[model samples]
Target: MSSLVASAVEYMIDAGQRSTLFLDVLRQRGDQYREHVAKTAPHVLQYAAELIVDGRDLIEPVNYALVRIVPPEGVQIDLERRPFVVVDPRAGHGPGIGGFKADSEIGVAMKAGHPCYFIGFLPEPVPGQTIERIARAEAQFIETVISLHPRADGKPCVIGNCQAGWAVMILASLRPELFGPLIIAGAPLAYWQGVHGKYPMRYTGGLLGGSWLTAMTSDLGAGKFDGAWLVQNFENQNPSNTLWTKQYNVYSNIDTEADRYLEFERWWGGHVNLNAEEIQFIVDELFIGNNLAAGKILMSDGQKVDLRNIRSPILVFCSEGDNVTPPQQALNWILDCYADVDEIRAYGQTIVYTVHQSIGHLGIFVSGGVAKKQHTEFSSNIDLIDILPPGLYEATFEAKGEATTSADLVVGDWVMRCEARTLDDIRAMGGNSPEDDRRFATAKRVSEINLATYRKYVQPWLRNALTPQMADAMRNLHPLRLQYHALSSKNPWMFLVKSAAEAIDGNRKPVSGENPFLAIQERMGKQIVQMLNSWRDAQEALSEAVFLAIYGSPALQAAVGIDPESEPARPRQMSPEHRMMLDKRVAELRSRIQEGGLREATLRALLYIGSARGMVDERSIAALRQVRRDHAAARLSLPEFKMLVREQFFMLLLDPEEALAAIPKLLPADDSQRRAAFVAMREVLAASGVVSGERAVRLRRIADLFGVEGDPQLSNVTSFDRDARASQGGENSQGLEQHHVG
Candidate 1:
């Protein structure tokens, strides 16, 4: 009886504590809400930004600005190393996410010792700034970064996140000479390409009766489009999270989660506006027309931005789980732009992509884990990526510490590898079918017509009605903005709630995790989420169905100028200049195939072996770099090295049999030199990790061609002296060296 009374007393005390804690949490939320209102009401960034540009001047002033990333205290930056320039998306939100946290894109680059620059924009865009003008401004920013870092190895490595992805791609195409390597994360290039049932965002324009809404909204804003609508669309996609889970999550762990929630909310709430012309161009040219990938969109300068013209290495980072820019949209441009792997090679373009199995779109830029691993590895190997031969490859990572069973979160040092990939592989990643392409083409035509009609019929009236003052008033009254301003301390009623919350906080009591009411609350929250999800799914299905019905009709198809009976258009053909460049390259390779010495021979053999495996890792490349450093005669300048690598790779492509046989001719007849070359080659293969059977066979064939005898296993040659000592007991390293090279 005494024990039961003690238990009851304990339970009552816990219940009271929980009740007080809940009230205190309510008060804290009010405080947070009030703080958020105060911060956002000013329409300025709450975070401190310290610029890094040598001169605090925009060489070509537009809305955008490029600032050097000031590394956190205690972090040293190497200006001589390749500079990393991160261009954050300008879609809806204001700039800063790329450098928002220590474990972010800029942070990773800073940690890697690269001079970092961030491309950001102001609260207000330059009046009448077009995407073309923005691209030019970005180019000027990059040129300034390049000028500032004249001592750096190559051109700046540019990273474009989300909306900035396409922006950089345009810049690269226009000025490929200015970029060394490009990393585009979570940016959609193929906007019309998405899975039918899974990706519903693609149908939105069609469901809303095409992109005329974009124009209408912009016009109503009196020449500026409110970005909050774009943010709202993103919110509406996941009703469960927007309506229930997000709030409930904070409520459940209110004490611990409030700071993080508020920090992210600060950025989320800070919406920026775009000029009417800019939004219209993006919606018409990219979202609806999908012309960028097709290489058909003519810039203001009259030159088409052909992606194939981008000569620098391109790294595309995307995620399968990114509903905003699905992997298909992120990657299907390869199909739109190139015919096959051979064509990519012929164009002298190196395209490498990495796809995460499951990370949301924003997580691709903001997640610290992604920064620590993918971004870190990419930065560490930026030089390697810059020098990689022109081809299509997929960058994959293997954990370095996975051998230790206790290592749970295997991060930090990672083995970065690039494996050759084909268009077929991209197709398997949910590449759109011909019918889907045709439907999107139809949507594009409908969009053009609607936009034209809107401009002709409705835009003038809206323009006449909307003054700048009226636009400002309408923007302020936006539901999304109103929500933030509503509960603010600006409301006289909230002061009482704030006072009560402070009192509750002083005597705060928290509930136990095992409380019966908490359990019921969780169950209720799950049910609400389920209902919201069901509604979302039903709404998406209805939208998709309606889109198909309207856009897929025979009459609509004819109206849009697409012939139902016609075949899909062929992939873009290589330019005459591109073809001539390939032809000249082939001639050069044929002429120089037999001109290289043992260094070239070994490199050729390694390329042959690596090609068979389709994968090359960092360890192997590092080992190869060490070999170049160790051998005086083997050292070459960057330009010479890149030329030789390209020449060797082309030779292999031209005639593998001839290239392999020609290896013996390039090497010295002396056994010692041949043995040294063999050992170096084997070291590279071994450092690349375990050699597959096919690679081993190729290694043997290269050995035979070089007139080297005995089994040529990579392990035997990795440490010739050690292997000799192990095989012949008591044999010293000196004896093995003599025996092998003599």
Candidate 2:
């Protein structure tokens, strides 16, 4: 009887503590929401930064601005290395996710000792800032960055996050000369590509009667579209998280989660406005029309955007878990842009892509783990990417350190490497099929009809009914914005809650994790989440079904100008002059196969081996760069080195047998130089510490061609092993074994 009495008293105390802690958290959240609203009321960035390129001051004014990140003390900048330009997504949310914290995209670049620039925008867009004008402003910003860093080794490595990904791609295509390499993370290029039942966002346009709604909304906004609608759509994508899980997680762990939750909310809550013209262009040319990938998007100056014009090596970073921009949508543009691997190579364009197994759309840019691993390696290997020969490849990361017991040590840090991949490999990753193409084509046609009908009948009424004051009131009173304003301190009713919360904060005690009632609360939260998820799943299914049924109708297909039997058009054939030029180039390469000195010859052999291996490892490339720095003979200009690489590649393409045989003649007759070249090549191959059948065969073939034995000491040695040996006075260029290359 005494024990039961004690238990009842303890239960009362626990319940009282839980109540106080809960109220205290609610009060703090309200305060934070109030602060966020007040802070962002003036169209300011959440994070502090100095503007470097104000598009308003440019010849063609745009609302976009380029800012230089203010790095923390002790982090020195190197102006000689390649600069990194991170363009944050302008999709509804305000800027700064790329640099919201010290462990982010901008932070990663800064840590790598590279000068970093951020491309962001104002809250209210310029009066008539079209996508084309914005693209031009971005080009000018990049050119300014380039001019400032003349001593830098290459052009800035441009990174585009989400919406900015397609923007940067357009810039790279139009002004390919200004970029060194391009990274597009979690960005949708192939807008209409997605699986039927799995990815439902693609069906939203079709279900809503096409982009007519977008136009109507813009009209209602009185010239500018409130980005709150876009934010609302993103929230709705994961109803379980939005409706219950996210808030509950924060509430349940209020003591530890408040800061992070508030920081993210500041960025998430700060919505930007876009000009009606801008949103209309995006929905028409890219989303519904699917014209960007089709090379049908006309610029402000009448030039059609062609992705094939982009010459920089393209790195597409996507994730399987990104529902908003699925892997299919992120990468399917490659299929539309290039006919085959041969065409990519023939055009001298290098394309590499990496797909994470599980990470959401926002996490691709904002996740700390991604910033540390992918972004770090990418910044460190910009030079290697710039020098990589034209081809398609896949970047893979392998962890190299010992395991640890910490949240930060997930499989230790990783080292990035690339492998040769074919278009078939990409096609296997949920690539679009002919039937899917036909369906989207039909949807596009239906969208045209629906949009026409809406404009002809509804737009005039909307124009007359919508006033700027009404638009402002409607935007502020949206459900998303209403929650913040309603619960904020500005509401007179929240005054009592604030006072009670402050009193509770002074004497608050959190409930124990093992409390029975706490477990019940968790269970209830999960139940609510499950219910929301069920509703979401049902809604998604219904929407997808309706979209498919409407767009799949025979009458709709005919009205939309789509023929079910027609096939996609083939790539255009090369002109006669272009063909002759390529033939002449091949001939020149064949003639000069044995003309160059030891430097050129060694590079030719390495290129031959690399081509055979069909991949390049970042560590090996790093060592190669070190070799270039160490050897005066290897100090060729970027253009000269590119020319040499192209010539050798063409020589190999012309006749592999003759190219391999002529490698010896291009080298010096001196045995020591031949041995040095072999040792260097072997060291690069062994840097990753793993050998495959293809690499082994190529190394053997190269050794046989040069009539030189691989060094036994360097055989199968990891990069660490070589470093240790060198530190202990080991031979750096010992002779290699005859049979084994490494």
Candidate 3:
């Protein structure tokens, strides 16, 4: 045992010596090496500074600007009536992510022929700006877009990515009429809620003992909180990727990878700052306190922010693999804010959420493939989302090639359907406990006390001591800022390293997968990473459990009065004006349904039923066309059509048997044509599990009497027919027999 221990000690000493030597060598070459590959800093800084200089340019500039959507060269947007606004997240990053490439959200909207506008911001926040100011600015931007596109049928369809998601929501809540349909991608409103053994970011506040550090950092920066700190925090979440994997991948394939890496780094490296007050408010009120969804957060002007106040339909996009903002954090806000699905429905909010199985947080905004599929589907079907009856739904997008309209012209030809989802299904994911809530509440209380103390004692002393020049110098000396500076042309050795790297780029030879040693090293590295991740997950789970146990106690709950399950009551009454508006909307909808609206609904139903059953029929086709024509008709009264549509829809829903029996009465009298129609109707109904076999045959025979051809398969019909015939009896049974006769 002594010899074994000696060997281990010896190995550890050797490893430590090697690591020290390697780090020393890296330190010596770090400035030159970083300069050689630092393509992002120069351009990123230029752009950042330009944004600060020309703040007005941050708002998109284009003609037909709101309604004239110019798609990518190859793609096409089918809907011209819908207006699109793509709001990029300002979370420690530069703008243009939402429209960075042709295969992006803006690209998809433009291709669809929908007028598109991008909501972006300057790198520097306006002096003394707060979240409320930003929210109001966004509201103004949206209003400007709306006014610019008078020809568009609805208010702008707003798409918000990450931090911008909550910003949009706050804006919509404050001015609900400014939005049409709101899409929030990977935003975390229920900040404290997350799945077990996954999503470590949520536990960070509790582990750090909450927002004091954030305040301290802001104070150190002289009232300007460096966004690079937020960027650093995001990087630390995945040390392997941030420190080694990313750079290694580019190094391994420099020839093809350089431009791609540089392009991404351009945005990634462009860190921006927030005012001390803004950052502190966000951390204390939203992140640590988890007050946003609870309706507990108040603006500087003392307006209580209520999420449910937003009257627009909401589409939430989250992913299971997004460690930064997991599915639970993105979705649990609904459950936190509202009593039940009924409350959501009562408030007339159409809430739809889609969960991707595996996409990182950034991928939710910047992935071309995701943008092509998810964004395209959402942009195309904004009208559907807006018109859907108030309820919670899981939206699923399926790609359809031949079935898609303008199939040859579209890149992501697909359809999106919003299917009803239950609250239990959402709750099955991880959620906040009473204890977790208490901890955040405690954090909020402590933050208030600490902030008050800091303002009273520390803030005045520091503010008076710091000058604008000193502040600028301190900002430039920030570690992240220094790295960018040290790598620029100002470094004397940078030229030599860049030349050498460029030369090396031409003849560089990387190890192939076929190399046995390389393969083994890769496998071992992956194994080590997996093991480390497992250990980390286990540790996080235990920590979270302990947090819940200690802080979730009844005494703690009593102290904080934190109840994750409790929700504020929804307002039961609306002002007379609001009620009248709803009444007008209902009347308008009813009118639309009455004017061949049943036909349109039937067509939609048949299309879905056919897609599910893999069948289609003439009646379905006819219904689809008739509805389209009715919609196009100028003089048609919609209220009457709405009634007819509802009557037919409920008839099918309440008593499908009787409804099917009555189909013979409405059939067109022409033997061959009628038979074809009957066959088509059969397929449609069959897809929905509405009818089959003998009952199907009997229905067909009745059609045959109305000049439709009856199938010979009636002879073998039994069971279902026998029951129906027995129940109806006498003349009906005889009618079935006579129809079957040769």
Candidate 4:
């Protein structure tokens, strides 16, 4: 053979050998997996079976007995005035993730002295519970909490994770008064949304031809939907982790990683079923149909499920690396639901979103880092979010050992600032698409058809076939269940391998590395995965393009009774009651603004504006307070004071010199107080890094007018010494109380 052909042959041969060797290793790993399963499965099975046997205790332990809060050892449950209800996602898994760690969302709230309640459920659904029933239960739970904490704020701050996000949104929409601040983390609102060529989960409905398959599966299970299907879908999203990386990590760190894996798997493997009705509704109304944002979803009671109707401030925490629910899906609801920021403002909605660059979906809720940073910041500053002006903002958390006065006080490792962004900026992140609407519309139709067919044909037969015994067996036989079951003593071979594997586990010390080989393998694996993902993207794009070409054509659109060019007409005339209610709300808000002094109003405005900019240095906040205090001290007539404050603020943007020059005019007329105020203003500017030699001279010159002597070195005070006293009576008044002007 020629040289080129020989090289090709060698390459093919090597590829085959690599494949064979890889398969051999995998086969050995599989045996190890089975052996590991034999060893560990019994404990899981026993744990789960105990829960099943003592179902009440398993589902509702005694510690959680009094509203079910089991405080950590050495800790007492101290209830704060505000009640906090944390709802964990029941997407595919069992409960307790939100409270799995002591420093979790529940923990943060609990530590902050809030009465924390965890909303958890059993691995099995209650015999005939539906989504509405669950929602009602949750609402009732919140109401009970509210009744218990009579002195608490209006209602409990309801935090919903992942799947619970929509459930919370639905609950809040259905009964707005029952909720306080609604914090939704890693929840997909605009479910049909995604960056082009990424987030394949959105495409699954289109590929599967809609939610009818969900109905079919539920029917197959004889009325109860299998949650393993959802877990399997999650696993499929990251095949390397599901198939290899996860097991390898355990094997590589067998001694230490085992407990963590088992702990996580206990919840991950504990699959919970949903009623066919519930899953079908979710897929059709929320995921595939995208009706929630469009104000199309209606409750059984006939109230339109308009997300905009939710009165509480909505806080969204999403991540870019979350393949299951990307930032686009989390944030696009704003763009879809409202015409503009003014509409959101008009409705008195406070919407805040934080986007992390790379945390996965689960980490948003479960990562301790996230708990310490995002969750902690959010829990501590929820009141801040509640008071935010109606607009969109990106919440940023920065870790600082010493926070400026402007930083909102938080309980944990980081302080957060809210930065505002335009709706157009949000739109630029990848939403502006009609294709999504088209695809989701198709999914909705196909789902309806399939569901109807399954109900008509398959329902009766499957229901008859599924006895309680059969259902139990099916649940036990589920792959997630088997991993636990096979490790149990119930397995015939488990006894033989259990002790031996335990011994091996004791002796088996892994060869540790800053493993260059492992690192290289990981990098290469990621590159390969990315390439495969790229290929998948190209395929999907081509498929969508073809689909749109065929179905989006004029002929097909007409055939389907869809008018591509048609627009939703203007909203129907507002009823007098609605108009009066809206007008009343506006008048009340305006009245509140009027009643609130300009100082309060300006501080609120500073918060609203500063949060949008992403960074709020000490200077901005100090300036805001100084301006407010100056205005108050000057006792300028309300209108003059407002204008003076406005001019100073406007100058703050245009000319710092002009703004500082304008500040002394707002000072108190009393020489002593005026001098004190000038010194205070100097300290504020110094803290904000706005004070300089020239600014110091101007300040001192102004202070001298009030009979206050200036320190010669004040011009040299580059840093604001936290301990150093501002000159009072030309000497340090060490014990004097420092007055806060703002």
Candidate 5:
């Protein structure tokens, strides 16, 4: 035989063996899925945890519960430190993705010495649970956690992963006092805000003729929305992953990949059910209405859940590659709620957002590398975030490198920085045009009409025809669930797969990486993925064209009660009291700009320089953190520190030169204390790097105001500290208190 023919034959033999083993691994996966479902309770957290508050026990029972993660053997939790509360999204799958592995959100916080609490839901939701009840239960759970850690320095840092993010926002707004800094990861607040050719998920509701289908499905399921439908929708978003690449990946690397695949599937395949009421509210009030940011959602009570009512600093994490919740959806809420960055500051809201270049939706929380990088840094700097001046900022990370100044000060491998951002910066990321918004509004109206029609006509028939047993069968027979059931050991056909897989595993001969047939197979897989991508693109484009054609017509928009000629109106209003409070606060801050001594002067100087630099690096924040530690006796509480920081930042922003001029009067008369504070303040300023351009000019101006040498050399913290000791009030030290003038 020719060499090529012989190579092909050998490759085929190896491929047969690998396929057998891969099939067996799938069988094992199915068996594991069965085992997972058979449990009365199952959570995939790879850590020891115990229940603290079970929502099922609440007066208004829910499937959600709070569990305290016990630190690993080597890790210790500091009882007095602020705790972390991680709330995983209850979109489709069961909870535990937040702690799916050892290096998860819970793991990161535990390793950082913070007590970790996870709020997850059971596979089946409570019969009568509503979103409002869930929020109240979450608040009560937080109260329990806070009560347990009485000596904690600050309130718990609450992390809401994906859909849980919006849920957390509701809780925080209603009871902002319960939260510290809020980390909302990959959560979409602005459902209608997205660029075209992306966010195909948004188009789903539009193409389905509004939420009528959702009501129809719920009726078919006997008033319970099978989460499998939601899961299928998510799967449909990436057909390649659903149909081929996911299984192919495990099949290609079956030896080392089976356990990991099974672990993720346990969470992914564990489809939960949502009470129809819950899904309807979500679809109408959140997804289609796009009302959360608009502050249009009224609770069961009279309270309106306004995102602006949230007092805790919001740290948003999103990725460009996340089709589920793109950066626009993650961030457009700011624009929806407030007119400008000034309005954000006026409301005393501090929002910091970080955009990763390419991590996917699940990767934002599930990827271990991300868990270590972004999550770790966010946890470490939770205090800094709590005290950040209220405004908009974008958090960016730079890798630690040879040129890193004060590299020892930075934690881990990345230098996290929060850069000041404006509303315009957010607008630059693509969003719906006025025309697009009108089209969505029209779709919303159409959805309402269609839903009413369904409820009046189709829904009644579905509700009457579908029995409980029938609904149960439908859920079991769902394609997403049926696959797991059919492939499990319970199936008579899969018995051979289990035995054959075991036999093949006993003496497997994997093909070489360079095998020509293997290479061809890999190429074929890519071709299939490409084919799916093309199909998805074509389908989405067609959906978009059809939607625009149907809804974009002026007559249709008018018929739907939206004027096509009018600009797309955003729901915006500041209560008269809110406006008056803002104005009053401005006046109050201006009156206090010239108040305080060493602490106030140093904080203002730092703010002045920070505003000029336009970004605050973690290293700089570390210096400030150290200063706080150094003067523990005089250190301010986090709330006080936050108040002072916002006061200083706003004071400067109102009138920079006046705020700078008042720096002197704010200082006390002690020369040593004055110089000591300057030295400490310079520690923060120094991390901003070589202060050239406007920053350098501002630094010179600050130095002149402090009666110190205006030379750039003095900016170095090491040299400044040495100089502070070497000479207490040198030739020019009239005491910056005496010299505090611009």
Candidate 6:
């Protein structure tokens, strides 16, 4: 009994010590937040960066700027390699979250020897700045980057995080030529897509009766919308994490977690402002109207932003735990844009997607583990993605396992495999039903009506009533803002806390893991989190229920000028023009079905095998690269290779039988030349171990087309003295001169 009392007393002392450390961490975070907010151009980027281009100086000025990341000590960057440009979302927070740490997107890309650039914006939007100007600025930035690297191997790779994802997509569709492989992390493209009970953010517009409130908020802010509201919405989505879990995590590991927490909060607390027009367009066109993927958005210059128009290989990375941009919204854009994989191929677009099981939206771009793994592999395989045949693929990465073949070919610890996917594959991941679409359409209509009504009835009084000074007061007095102010040294009362924290830091005594009191505290914290989560879930459920009840009414739909029983709102498809273009393209490809020699034949063979297996792995791709490096007399630029691959793929897709038969005609007549080509082809085929199943059968057919028998496995690789076309007077460099739709 005496020993138990002694232990209990010891537990109390340790708990008191840990509590002090936890309080000190919060005090430090508050101080950091104040410092960050007070700065004129504050950012949380851990890396030192040099300014490259300021968009405010452009022809049509914007707030965004481009900065080149200066690599840290021991990190090397190669100007000749593709440059990586990371664009951070401007939904609410200040920029630089993309490079918030050393093990971030910029870090890994720089570590991989690629020069990196970041696109950030000031806390205030430039007067009259719009998203269109911002996008044009980004295009100019890429052009500037290209000008700087005159001899780069490939075009700059653009990675867009969260809100920046859709913005990048808009620009890519507008100016596809300026981009290489495009990566969008945790970005929602299809606004109306989500599971039945999950992702309640999609239901927000419906419950709020549209973007009228957004307009009102803008009015109240005196032509600028406060981003604090956006941040608040994000917080309300996960109450447990926002209110308790995060702080508890810091408290539990205060000694190691303080600096990281403080750094993140510095950016998280630095809210920015968006022009009323900018926020309105985002809400009306993207959130409520669901128009980006539908190709209904047209720029001021009158060019339609068509997802199908983007030829740069698009890589989408989303996570299941990402409430902000769940996999449904991230990936369903494919369904909204194209009818099928054949249409995707016809458009000559390559798309790849990866879904993480549990990483949240911020973690998708900010987590060191994700950067070291997903971002690293993405950086390493930019070339492979660039040269992929126009189609839809699901990219997956796995650690080295017993089944992994040609492990030496992979540069990293994980091997990436891209399996061909169909529209059905995307459909399997849950999307809005036709009924759900009608409801959302009704909501959209209602939103339009409400906004019109508000402008006519409410705006005049509210616009004149709220002055700039009043707006500033409201922004500063926001709960999100007030919290930082209350805890900072700006508050006279916080001086005591700071003094105590400093004293505690000098004599910190964190509790042992086995402490009984610490366990009880942890248990209580978990219970509080559970309570908060329950409230969040209930609130979301109520919102969804209210939205459905109000918008699901047939009477309301009729009043809103929508047919409840009619076909849902499909994407804006320019059927006749697109069909004519496709037919013309098909005719051109068919005309050249029996053209070229080894180059055309090799591409056709690979496309044929890929179609047969419906999958592609790293080994095959690596071997193909190796064969080109060893055998080809002249190197094919990325554009040239992409064109050749697409042309051959189109040939096979148009008429598989004729394409295979023409392979023999395309081959060299000399047996030695044919053997050299055939052997090199077989070497790539066998790179992923013994190719069996339908792929092997396709391989044998390709071999037969070249008049070769017997399967030559990986070990039987023969070095081609030179490319057949090169030796035979560069026969019909098929795709070198022709420019496709950019």
Cα lDDT of all candidates, in order?
0.77, 0.76, 0.61, 0.61, 0.83, 0.83
**Candidate 5 — which residues are off by over 4 angstroms?**
709-742
Say which prediction, candidate 1 or candidate 2, comes out ahead on lDDT.
1
Q: What ranges in model 2 sit over 4 Å off? A: 1-48, 402-412, 568-584, 637-643, 690-697, 707-742
TM-score each candidate. 0.89, 0.90, 0.72, 0.73, 0.94, 0.93
lDDT of 4 by residue, 644-697 (tens): 333332233333333333333444455555444445545544443443333343
Model 3 residue 390 lDDT score = 57
RMSD of 3: 9.3
In the predicted model 1, the residue pairs found to clash are: 17-509, 17-510, 18-510, 18-511, 21-509
List the lowest-lDDT window of 10 residues for candidate 3: 733-742
lDDT of 1 by residue, 526-567 (tens): 999999999999998998787777767778788778987668
In candidate 6, how many Å is residue 335 off?
1.4
lDDT of 2 at 616: 73
> Could you say which candidate leads in TM-score?
5
Pairs of colliding residues, candidate 6: none
Which digits, one per residue and each the tens of the lDDT, describe model 3 over residues 240-323? 677666765654444466567666766776777788777877888778877788788777688878888887889999999898
How many clashes in each candidate? Answer: 5, 6, 15, 12, 1, 0
Candidate 2 lDDT tens digits, 577-677: 75787678667777877677777767776766555445676767666766777787559866567667767666666666777788887777787777777
Task: List residue ranges in candidate 6 displaced over 4 A.
Answer: 571-574, 710-742
Question: How many Å off is the CA of 735 in candidate 6?
Answer: 25
Model 2 has an lDDT value of: 0.76
Identify the runs in model 1 with alpha carbons over 4 angstroms from their true place: 1-60, 402-413, 632-634, 637-640, 668-671, 705-707, 710-715, 718-742
Per-model root-mean-square deviation over C-alphas: 6.6, 6.0, 9.3, 10.3, 4.9, 5.7
